[model samples]
Target chain A: MAMSQATAAGPRRNRVLNGILVNGTLALICLLWLVPLLGLLVSSFRERSDITTSGWWTVFPHKSYISAKQDQLTKGLALDKPIQVEGVSLTDDQLRAGYTLPDGRKLIWANRRARIVDVQTSQWTTKANFTTANYQAVVLGQTYTYKQSDGSTKTEVGEDMSKAFINSLTVAIPATVIPILLAAFAAYAFAWMRFPGRRPLFAMVVGLLVVPSQVALIPLLRAFSNLHVNGTYLSLWLVHTGFGLSLAIYLLYNYISGLPREILESAFIDGASPFTIFLRLILPLSVPALASFAIFQFMWVWNDYLYALIFLGSTPDTQVLTIKLANLIGSRGQDWHLLTAGAFISMILPLVVFFSLQRYFVRGLLAGSVKG
Target chain B: MIHQTRDAENKRASSAATSGWIPGQFFAGLLGVVVVIALLWAGFIYLRAARSASILNAIVAIIWGVGGIGALFYVSNTLIEALPQKSRDRIRPFLFFGPGVVILFLFLTIPTLITLYQSFFNNDTTRFVGLSNYIATFTDRSMLESFRNNLIWLFLGTGFCVSFGLLIAVLADRSKFESLAKAIIFMPMAISLVGASVIWRFMYAYAPADQPQIGVLNAVLTSLGLQPQSWLTLQPWNNLFLVAVLIWGSTGFAMVLFSAALKGVPGDLLEAARVDGATEVQTFFAIIIPYIQGTILTVTTTTAIGTLKIFDQVFVMTGGQYGTEVVGTEFYRQFFTNRNFGYGAAIAIVLFIAISPVLVYNLRQLQKQEGF
Candidate 1:
């Protein structure tokens, strides 16, 4: 009894230590986890040049710099000619630009490197500049004028997602609705209907759940072309519905089959036809399951790339947000601001869906994982 | 004569109710289904014939898509109602399960068979080359590199996602900010893999040492007086870099699952262990972990499956350059870019074969959980 009492305080101390260690580690990890997302969010608001010149963390009070070299001054500096730099006269040819003398004035040069004579210099200073210009450019397409490899300037509209957003809706709404409708019916049958092949068919659905979509891609495309539906939104609608059916049916069956068997049996005894039971009783009670599966289907279809890339070729009108965002990276990867903004734009809908329907999202995930 | 008149009156009364609702339901359903099909057909034509940028096409497509599927279900139910009662009883399950089964068989099963057959043919799918394509897939240098990269991704991505998820879940359990911490970490799961790639690409951004370093990793390195490395160009490490993106995107899913499992761990067991003078560390590994071991295996397999099928991050970030190719991207390249249909089909088959064992194991686990 004395020994037990003595160790009580020691246990309390250990509990306190455990508390701090656990919470502290979790807090640190949470912060680190947000870093990459933060980088993108911050970079999205920065100017293109600032994104290229410094890290997104350094967005506040950015300092511009200009460096000078000795060889450039010797090659381009004219003897006995006065050079004007940031309203300061440089009479000496050897001084060059970006030279900090013993005075308060520090000479800097243009942001770009050029010949000494062509390098117009300026005063170095800090600017707290931030802009929504990148977003604006993305939303309202910018006509970019860039020098071509053939030494000709070409003007083209930068890739934007305003139209692709509509395209995603076109693909996603049907994709989500079709699969759910089909799966709900199949689930109802699998759950309540008396069928000879129920167990084997359900097993097949489970098997199909893990079939890699890659195996289905080429042949499906060929079939679509044969059906004269390739490169159409309808094609993707069918493809997604078919591809998603296995999981949808599996999830819905899990929920629908578990409904109180007594209620269904009683309805059957009351001369309620299977059709009426499904239309009236099963549909209403299955709303939560339906909603959860709908959310999953919507999110998956919205974020889908491979199907969109293959079926909805990257034509301006047919491309979804994901396709546009990907093509933007492929063509103009160095434009970090544009890339980040475009990425965030693509994420906006899914994030909203995720946050608003998080309960269903979590339920659906649990059903998939815990049950599996 | 009096009995006949009374019977006629009763028959008339019952028929009046059926005539009122039955025809109205059938016509409305038929009209809706027809309109939906018509709109979809027209929309497909417009997409192909006109510019894809038309908003009208998108709107029409969505309306037809969402409305059409629902209308089809209604059509079948109303059709059953319009039938003789005996026929209706025989056809109800077909109405429920037919559409889903037919779509799956057409799109998934048929396509799978076609691809399997095509894998035996040549690039143009003309000559029957037998297993030469599969042999090429195994023997080519680039193919070997892709296989190596996929293995790296599978191990590193699955390892980090499950372990980190478990760690975070255990640490954050019962913390005051548990929900908040989990929400932030879970945010990336809402973003597409392409978006995640864009975010991480910024973190691995690099510039010449003389120039300002924009990438966070490179920037941090230069600040520490180390040379900035071209992260994506560094072989072996480049593959790891891509794997990191998958880990980042997937950890949230694992964490969510693990957190739920942790919540299900018996609290009384922990209390009992504590009363037995077991330290928190000992209790954690002994009581909590063993309880959630099933979840750990489930999450690990889930993540590994996802990692094996990973395509978006690598497609967007590296394009399989600098020895970072994997199976999914390689399939895309061979099929779409290189136009090597046979080789692409073979690569896809390899991916499908790799997933079968995992799929069987997952299904077995699910069967156990559901007790079916």
Candidate 2:
């Protein structure tokens, strides 16, 4: 280990500085990673109006309010002497600026000359208010209600992105589940099952790994359309499955094959059928491999736009998260806050999934796939 | 001990194994009858033959859907019996591999044969165009450009991802803070491609003439008194920028693989080098590199293959805009978007052909390592 360390780099002090540089670089990276996420969380709290006008970070300590002069209608507290209104005591110029109104009237732009009236109060007192409306707009609410920076009340139509969020789930979960289930079984066959032409069959699948799925999209779509499966969750789910199965099976095969042969033999001798061995013995032992591949396939399909796009279309109801983000940009004209917020919204689930499952990655997938 | 266990298991195994093929037993006798009936159906279609294409398409579907399933099972079970007695005990495992074979054939092999046929046809899908499709792809400016850019993708994209990933993995190994640093670097891997594209879109964001650049990188450049640049829209450079995203995403994969390989390097080898009074840098070049050479080669090959077929990032980021077309992205654009089946097939062939060298090398290396 020490020899490997020496050849790889210098001693501890040198490594320490290298470590500092790496961590510093990573810290900057973390900040970079967090910006979009931070923007989302901040955007969730901010009013649509504020989001459009200022960056999310500008929200705190910036003190945004419309200020105006409110004439104390009763002659502005006339003193006992009732001094003549010399120079219009406390003239409009002296009325001071920046005030909020108790009536919830926001001052767009104010000048001292404006005065309060029964029907119209131009005199705006500084009003600083915060509400949970933005949160409602994002989670379990609407996309259109979010205000634009250019002071436009933008409204989204037809299927809400949130519905597509569920639609994405409908596509993603099945696309993920079906392939892993199939692959786990296939991987077992490739790994432990004694079969004629096993190598060729496994090779065919692995060789397909290099055969890009982009090649199959059109024909598959045509086939699906002919089968009346086009534009259905079933279509995209199958597309993901067909595309994912090769790699997933290969990866799982490696992990399963790497397991000690004795356990499997023991199971076989106990009269446990193949299915029984897989269910009771192999499956539990292969948890780490399964988790890693699950993370992999989940992330891949969840972020996938092409398969979903080609098979599912731009139909708002069937759009996956990727398509939704694409539309948000194309239609909304780069509403940064909303895009950031929406981008982060789509990512939260994947992040949690990857972070939680990443620990299992230590098992060395490639180890089994290749020989020592 | 083994013999005693084997007899106990045989009683349990025989029943379970036979039960698994019970459906096959049921179908075995009926298959002959069904084939005769199916021929009659085909003959009926042949006689009506006015709608031959529709019938032909249906026949294709049935062959793929039904015959494909049957073929897979028959092939799988037939092969199962051919293994030596030592390996024959793996019957229970073969059952799981059944579905993977079916999906692989249905999706990959059949489609490949179809693509070969399609490459000979015209855009309308009715006329055979011979070698003209492949010829036009070579002569056409856009197709040629996509090929050139894909080479750039293969060389530079995979090149950076492997080198940088190896650099990071080597540095992070044997460190106190290894896991945390790796986690942060791997964070991008967790994000969906869309989310990463969105995050990067902000980082590479360009606004019209006078707008303040919101992308962090551009923001920094402007802050540094340099003019803001449109990173993604820059013709040649945009390809590299897109590649950067791939590097960020795939480096963790390379890192983890190399890291695992690093673990397998024995410590005594390194200690011997140290006792020889080898300098730190000398030790790395002399000892570590050679020890982990197999893994480095594997990582490089895997990453190279990955880059050869990259589509998602480019498709999402720029849709192959600004002369940044790659084979994977261009194949989709040609076949599906433009409805040009011949050109798409030609490009797909090119990609498959291009990846063959690396594939062969990887296979050979994998075989040599595995002693298969």
DockQ of each: 0.45, 0.25
What CAPRI grade goes to candidate 1? acceptable
- Weakest 10 consecutive residues of candidate 1 chain A by summed lDDT: A111-120
lDDT for each of the candidates? 0.79, 0.66
lDDT of 2 by residue, A1-372 (tens): 988987767567776886787666655654654565455556555565655444445544544443333322433433333222212233332233322246654332122223331212443232234455543444555544655554577675322457667766766765666676678778887777667778777767767776767567657777887876777665775678788888888788878888998988877667654655665677799888887777667777877777877888777656777888877666763665466667767878878877777765434345333332
For candidate 2 chain B, the 10 contiguous residues with the lowest summed lDDT are B47-56
For model 2, how does the per-residue alpha-carbon lDDT over B1-372 read when each residue is reduced to its tens digit? 645645554653464455543344345535644654465456334423222123233344334333434444444443443333344465535556767778788877788778778888888679988999989988988878888887887788778777776766766775567787677667777677777777677667765435555555665677697888889888788888888777777777777777777777788988898899897679878988898887877777677777878777788778888988877887888877798887888777777777677656655554663514
Candidate 1 lDDT over B1-372, as tens digits, reads 434533543453345345633566567667766876686577567644543544565566555555666677776676565554555556778778887888788877777778888899999899999999999999999989888888998898999999899888887785778988898888888898888888998899888988889888998899899999999999878988888888778899999999999999888888889889898779888888899998898898778888889888888888888888889999999999998898888888889899989778866765675434
What are the clash counts of all predictions, listed in order? Answer: 0, 16
Candidate 2 stretches with Cα past 4 Å from truth are A1-135, A141-159, A267-279, A361-372, B1-96, B208-211, B365-372
Per-prediction TM-score: 0.84, 0.74
